[model samples]
Every structure is written in C-alpha cells, then in structure tokens.
Target: MKMTKTPIKVRYQETDQMGVVYHANYLVWFEIGRTAFIESLGFNYHDMEQEGIVSPVIDAHMYFKQPIRYGQDAFVKTWIEEYDGLRTTYGYKIEDGEGNAAVTGSTKHVIVKKESFRPVSLRRVFPDWHQAYSDAYKSEE
Candidate 1:
C-alpha cells in the first residue's frame, strides 16, 4: 500500500474537558487524510467539484484504540483500500507521535453528478484518476 502521512497537532478545541480528543474529530482527521491522499495522486477534490463531480461518503467504520490528548502531535496515514469503477474506500490510521495507533478507520465513497446526485463512475469522468487508484490498490497485492 502507498500510504500518505499527514501530521496534525491536536488543538484544544478538538478535545473535551478531560483533554482527550473528541470522537467526532477523528472523522475530520479522516477527511484531512483522504484529501491528502487524493492530492498526492495529482488530483484534488476542488477540481472534481468544478467538473460537476462530487464524492460523498456512503459508509464509515472506525476503531478507537487509544486516547490522544490535546497538545499531542499525531499523524494520519492513509491509503486506497479499495476502488471499483464507482465506489472507493479510503483507509486511515491515526498514530501518536511515537507511531502508536490511536485510531483506525475506513470510509467508502461513491462519485456522483453534482446536479443530479446520481452515482457516476470515476472512470467515466476521470480516467486517469481512476487508473491511478487502481494501480495504487493493486500495488499492495
């Protein structure tokens, strides 16, 4: 797998009274990781939007392993776990500064036409981007 790592400094706003990161904030981190992965592939979500394509998360699964406190530096490692013509799954791992996993998750998304909200195949809209995802996913096997 070709993993892209994005470093994040846990901000006070992301934590609770106990100083542990709020559960919902992990999903935001996942978005950050996902955006980074797409950018790393030489494409970006903004361009997709401009082309009238939108990718929305259809499914998400997360596992919390450890607590991350405010002021801690963490990293989100991301990779393309699966990608078909229409649906793509991005996997993510949030690790503390020491490389210990604090959370792991995956988000599945499907490309859609921005106006109609109908599902569309990435291969049809962006062949190069689709191929890049396929190549990256196959590289792990």
Candidate 2:
C-alpha cells in the first residue's frame, strides 16, 4: 500500500498545563496528514475545490494509544484504505519519535458538488484520481 508520512512537531501551545498534547490537536494533525496524502497523489484540496469539487468528512474516529508531549516530533502515516464511486476512506497512524505508535485513526469522506453539496462520483468526474486511489487500496472498491 502507498502511504505518506507527515512529520509534525508538537508545539507548546498544543499542550495543556500537563505538557501533554491537547486532545483537539490530534484533529489538526489528521488534517495535516490528509493534506500530505493528497499532495502525495499529486493533488491538492484547494485545487480540487477550484475544479468545482469538494470532499467533506462524513465520519471520523480516532483512538489514542500513548501520550504525546510538547517538543516531541510525531509522524502521521496516511493511506487510502478504500475508494469507490463517491466515497473515500483514509486511515492514519501517528507515531512518536521512538517509532512507538501514539494513535490510530480513520476518516470517511464523500465528494460533492461545491455549489449544490450533492454527491458526485469521482470515478466519473476525475477518473485518473479515482483510479489512483482504487489502485492504491487492496480491497474491493
């Protein structure tokens, strides 16, 4: 499977008084990972929206395994877990500097028309991108 790893440096602001990363910071890291994954595929979310398409997350879930502290470097590994007609599921794993996993997560998103917010099949609108995602995933699309 093709995967992209985006490195994130945990900032002081990302931590609470306890010096551990705030709960919400993982969400931002997920977005960073997603963007890196998209860029790895030679596409960008901003450009996709300019092309009249927008993908919005419909479902998301994250599981925390270990605590990440400020000043620690984290690695977010992202891959396309599934891609069909209108939906794509992305999976992620975050690891600490020691290569120990800190979190595991996945997000499901659907492509829609930017103007109407109606579902659109990426296979029909952007066949190359769709095929790339499909080919990257191992399971049935």
Per-residue lDDT for 1-141 in model 1, tens only? 778999987999999999999999999999999999889889999999999989999999999999999988899999988888899999999999999999999999999999999998898889999899988888853
- How much is 78 displaced in model 1, in angstroms? 0.3
Tell me the spans in candidate 2 whose CA falls farther than 4 Å from its real position: 139-141
> In model 1, which regions exceed 4 Å deviation?
none
CA RMSD, predictions in order: 1.1, 2.3
| Model 1 poorest 10 in a row by lDDT | 132-141
| Model 2 C-alpha lDDT per residue in residues 32-83, reported as the tens digit of each score | 9999988887888887788998899999999999999988889999998777
lDDT of 1 at 138: 82
Error of 1 at 63 (Å): 0.5
Clashing pairs in 1: none
Clash count, one per candidate: 0, 0
